[model samples]
Target: MATFLRENASELGVRYVIWQGRIWSRGAGDQGGWGRPYDGGGVYDPSDATGGHYDHVHVSVRR
Candidate 1:
């Protein structure tokens, strides 16, 4: 989960983390929280859970 990755990002070599349409880089302090509209305020639709990644999460690692 986001909390775990954020706590161990440095040690785990995490480069980025994405969940619910919001992104968090290793050092980017929560990115000011998720669910902010983008691209004409339609990038994320709260009711549909379609634009945002409400179902799954994505993680990236450093090589």
Candidate 2:
């Protein structure tokens, strides 16, 4: 689901996306497409299964 939007962000007017806690913006750098490692502010963690897109996905679209 997230991959679809990311691959087609321009055509879909996607401004931002927050899923599983990680965030992605239109102009943001690659940076692994996830949050920082130390802050615990991101959604993905190898040791933690509860972090990443397991529950839901949040998307911000442009008007």
Candidate 3:
């Protein structure tokens, strides 16, 4: 994800902040149909990608 962000940072105006086991947006906020404090956890998959229980990325974009 870091590589992807670096490649499109300028074009997409991407910005981020990391805290409390989650990443937050410095710019984009609750605009992708997702509400603030998006918690990326649901069904637990043992063989899921990221080699973790959840197959999603946690992102919080608001205070």
Candidate 4:
């Protein structure tokens, strides 16, 4: 899913994607990869897994 999203981010107007405690941002360049750890939008709980996005994917789109 991440791979498909990254590949078509431009067409989909995706600004960023968060999953599994990591994030991939379009502005960060592809080389940055999805290795950047997500801060969970500063609303994460200590007991939450994968920055609160462990069970599903979080996608942010450009407006």
lDDT of each: 0.61, 0.63, 0.41, 0.74
Candidate 1 residues lying further than 4 Å off, grouped into runs, are 29-31, 34-51
* Best by the TM-score measure: 4
Give per-candidate clash totals. Answer: 0, 1, 0, 0
Q: Which number leads on lDDT?
A: 4
Off by over 4 Å in 3: 17-63
TM-score of 1: 0.61
The order by descending TM-score is 4, 2, 1, 3
lDDT of 2 by residue, 1-63 (tens): 777787789999998666655667787765654632222354346234455444666577989
Model 1 poorest 10 in a row by lDDT: 34-43
TM-score of each: 0.61, 0.62, 0.25, 0.74
The count of residue-pair clashes in candidate 3 stands at 0
Per-residue lDDT of 1-63 in model 1, one digit per residue for the tens? 866876688999988766666766754554356423222135556344544555666567888
Global CA lDDT computed for model 2: 0.63
